[model samples]
Target: MTSPHDDPPRRPPVISSPRRAAVSAAAVTAVLVLACAALASAGGPADRRDPTADPAPEAVATSAPLDVAADRLTDQTGLAVTIDALSPAALEPGNRLRLSGQVTNVGRGSWRDAQVYLDIAYDPVTTKGALDDANSSDEPFGTRIVEFGLFDRIGAVPPGTTTSYRLDVPYAELPLSGAAGVHRVGVTVLVTNRDGERVEAARADTVMPLVAASDPTPPPAEVVIVVPVTAPIARHQSGNFLDERIAGAISAGGRLRNLVDLIEAVPPDTLEIVVDPALLDAVQDMSDGYAVTTRQEEADQGSGRNGTGQVEAEEWLADFQTVTARQNLLLMAWGSPDASALASQRMPGVVAAAVRASDEFAVDSGLITPTVSWQKNGASTRRGLVVSRIAGAVIQFVAADNLVNLRAQGESAYLPSLVTVPTEEGELTGVVTARELAGQRLTMSTSVLDFRQNLMAEATIRSLEAASAPSPMVVALPFGWNPGDAAEVDVATAFDLATVEPVDLKAVTQSTPAAYPGPIRLTPAQSPLSDELTDAIVRLRTNGNTFTSLLTDNADAAAFDRRLAVSATSLWLGQPQERLALIRMESRAAAEQLRKVTVTGPTFVALSSRSGRFPLTITNGLQESVTLRVDVRAQNPALRIDPIAELVLEPGQSRDIEVTTRSDSSGLTPVRVRLSTVDGKVFGAPWEFDVRATQIGVAIWVVMGAGSVILVGTVAFRLVRRIRTEGLHPREEPNP
Candidate 1:
């Protein structure tokens, strides 16, 4: 008898007859086989086995089936995994996919016996819609690669603690085959939950694009990448910077600086940069010496601090000029105005003026001629198209969603990137930006490898849709896009793919336009400039014209046009307060400049006689010499005044002019004086005064003359009498 916890004793084997002996031997052999199987399944002698090495295939086959709920396999878990890097960005033959990142336990419970495995979907995403779904899907689908010891075994992760993980698996070992397009790849963590079951706890998914060497290279697709180099509106109407933010933007690590760096990194002709000439002009001023206002009111008051980026501005400008010298430069309107907004407001003159300023800047800066026009957000209306055409734009870049009757054959089919739009002026070649790609806003959060893979996937799918036929595509980078230090390489690598053929904007314009199913349809402007802002811009333009008319040189007026355009930039679309403030500032500056050249004189002038001369002073407070015409008028018809045909005054010079006046009657007469341009356009406000002429009448002069003659005759008669009567007075003369 044995106790409940005690082990029972075993009897010794005994052989009886020949048949009994055979049966006993069979039982013994069976027992020996069972013991051997148990040891092998347990990975016999753990000290003799390599923990890091993969176990025999038989070991995995003998293990219990993975017990996990299919619905809960991708459920959120305690661990949060983030992939910091992916080696060999694109999938290539004979290369291994290496991923390194951090795993943090964010839940209240700890994760024990944690393991990170590579998960991949073997099937390639062949359509744009499917690719979009994969990129955006929260519960992405993938099968874990649990063979060949390809996962990292991170022991345990306590609550609110993080641990690093690295997984390297050969490409051939990956569970993908058959297709060479974009495939879904991800990392999943298998941890022992509190229930003591090994299950997927957390996962992160990304794209992996593969371009095999053996695949036949089709006609390369024409790709036009339009990159916008712009900054916020920071310039005042007086050619001074309103703030110093622009200086930082063009510095070493600034947004504008990164743009220049990206341009320099890529092939010179690969990218078409839409540059705001106003930005360049502002930078040029900053390089020479600039004033930054502490307040908006100070901009016109000429009370501001000097900028501190003269050196940086000079270096940046020099580098920009050098880098852009060989690149394709598409000049934006002088201030990068909102063309669609201006068009919607029916202010075509402002748009035309902006375009003219851009053209002039292109010529003056020695940059390439601008043939293509791009509106903010790639949105435009029918009127905008016509206005752009009239403003010398042969081609216009528009958002794909803004056009109708432009659908593709299927979800996987390539959308036409070029079309022809009819306008009043002529036909415009419309370059449609790929809506899918542009929607994926590139930012610091997106890894370089991920972005490159996404781009490659798009290119591959589009090429496949067209049966490898040459397809023209255009991708417009978002305005003010800042590819951080990590993403700079991605931007350059995206275009370096073998399937991508970089082409100039001219090339895209020359390509055949895709046929639409019916008449082309254009959407209305999404968000245009408000009526108040547009009206303000109109007033600014009018005032600016008047102010510039005072300049002796017509060329000087170009600066004002550029400044007015700056007030209507797309940067002000959502900034109503700032836009209004800027417009007011510009208007005030213009008014102040116009007031500089004025006429001044005493409020009252007295003329003692007819044809008397009075003095009036004219002052030129402008920095440059001016040629002005002075016109004088008297309110009373009895008074007459002469006009000064033309007068030249040096800068900051004031001189008094003599006015000849004649009065038919003597009384107080109101007089007005004004300054005008040589072309007879009124320059500034009129100066008014009163002239009191005390002139002597003609009758009085005649009476006085007659009296004087009579008196003289009488005197002569008296003198003769005296001479006869006082003949003896001669002796008195001798005494005198």
Candidate 2:
């Protein structure tokens, strides 16, 4: 979290139109007038002239000239400053002097009014001779100084306006008696703005030609200058674009009822979220460390370093955007920003976006916010104007997370691996061939044995070339290629390729809406029944959630999605038995048999089983004659259930059904299998299953045998002892 103190004072983006520019210019003019008025009344920083104490004052000869007019003053800001203008000056050996100038605003906004200070220095002629393009100017000798400031108010003057100020220094204040062999004199100004932004401006004069006396009192050559960077004041009226957009949202419908409600209420918008650099840095420091892509390695690969730089940039930007968007929704949901600020109204939107972005971006590559800082380099009125641009933005994409990472990984080596595949004779052509052999047989696989093993005995065998041979066909093998191996020839199919095209570098579009991570089926307006169901959808969206979490212990997730289909099952459903929720869920279900789905990850679906039994409970509540028919379907072809058929039950009849499932060779994981119902809701009991090996009656048998052997052995032993020793067990022997 960024502290209020950490915020970089910001100037809103330049929304300069002809009219606006004129308005801004007029505003600047007004600011200058105000600055002059403030200066006259304030007496220019009382702190600079604390007369009464400090050891005492020294008297000097009237013949001596004053070295400087003003001594010390301070202004802080971030804008970079250059000398724009200066006042004329004359200097005599022992005379005092004054200097004045203006600092212009160069950054985005105005700095709240602040004072500017001067640094006076003296350098010997020899020292000046040593100065070069790279060297800093040195202080000259015998300079007296005083301090003064202008434009000290709550806000900065608008950019393009010049705020002028002056300072007076008397020569007697100088420590030097007057060493003179022609020393160079220089003055530099430092201004600090309200936001702690700093700007440095300087001017030097090395042409002061003077001759020193044989008995000379040497001047002090050291000068110290400290500039403060102040934060810029944030200013706005109620009619900004942001205000209008938010107002529109409020007019449509104030606060969103929930996450789904919010989505339904608004279309997607391009958002830029700004975060405190300091807070972000702290978060990054505490976060799980990022993957490091070395500079040397990237260079070797002919690519940019910081493999996740762009990824992190995008994610941080996106998360910020999402959070802000939710904030807007909260404002709408609660009817006003003030209302949304209340915990009750804020929580739902905050939590929802957190949960959504967290779950969505978890598996994402380089999804982290990084810290940044701003340097004040220019001036706005007396304030420092500072700004930095976002690194850059990628074209908006539906699967942006995946698409971005993939792009970063470089063009898919697997792309060319698709389309035309080399075969024994030639290449397989067209989508028909591609689809037929999609997962049927590895088109790139050269191993005849494995190919024949998985294929049906009567399966069609089409060689790349026409063949008249009886059993097998042969052709020239490409040199340097392994003869019989299934290689991933192409990762993309023609259908997949059709979805994307190359984008020009300079032509990249901004804010292209990315399909909000599987928005087609699991939309913002919809919610899953179970946390498990939610996990399943998230897994579908991000490929991050585990399938194990989605399944009912021993059952398949797809099977659960099917058998457990009802209003009570969706995670989005309100508290169990909520009247409004129940009705809404039922209506949604009735409107759609199976939601349309388009998966963008791996195309195959698969399933696995552990051990647990889902207790199935059938309750017959209605008094009228009724019948129920349940049909199950798995989304993935590889998923299957035993006895895949309709389950029928007559009125007043109830039965428990245990359906088992496993994945076939296709490896297509079942996202969900739907169980259609004809009448009455099916309430599924929690499934349970023994995970270890099934023992059956073995434990009972083992115990019974052990008991019988112990009894028989004890009796026999007692009888033998009784027989051996006449004193024993006539009872025991007789019983035996």
Poorly placed runs, candidate 1 (over 4 Å): 1-80, 103-114, 154-164, 190-202, 288-291, 296-306, 409-412, 438-447, 467-470, 486-496, 514-526, 572-575, 599-623, 628-683, 686-736
- Clash count for candidate 2 is 95
Reference-based lDDT, residue 217, model 2: 27
Pairs in steric clash, model 1 = none
Candidate 1 has its poorest 10 consecutive residues by lDDT at 15-24
Write one digit per residue (lDDT tens) for candidate 2, span 1-736.
1123322222222221100000011122333344444554567432243565442211111100111111111112212222212221212446654544344443334655334333333432222112211022222222323222211111244544555544445544433324333222333333455556654322222222222331332222110001111111110111011112111111212111111132222223211122222223212322332223222332243322222233333444344345444421111000011111111212222222222332222224244432111111110000100101111111111111111221111221111111222333332211100111102212221122212211211111111101211111111111111211112111111112111121211121221111211111122322223444333333232211122121123233222222112111112133433323323332333222221111111223222232222223343333323333343335544444455344444444466665555443333333332332343233222222221122235577889999999999999999888788887534554555
- Candidate 1 lDDT tens digits, 1-736: 1124322122112211100000011122223344344455677532255777643221110000111111133225645565656767667778998887767654446678887777677677666666766665436365566654577778788754668888888888876665767777777777887787777776665676666642775445567777788877666655667666788778766778766777777766887778888788888888998888744457437667788889889999998888887678778766767777777777777777778888887787676677456666576666776777788765677777677667653342566777776666656667877645512444223333445556666676665555633457777766665554434244566666666677887777676686532343345545667788788888788777776777776676887777777788876565687768778777877778888999988788898877788788999999988888899989997898866668888889999988888887889998988888777777677889898988787899999999999999999999999889987455544555
TM-score of each prediction: 0.71, 0.18
Candidate 2 segments exceeding 4 Å error: 1-616, 619-736
For residue 521, model 2's alpha carbon misses the true position, in angstroms, by 32
Scored by TM-score, the top model is 1
lDDT of model 2 at residue 520? 15
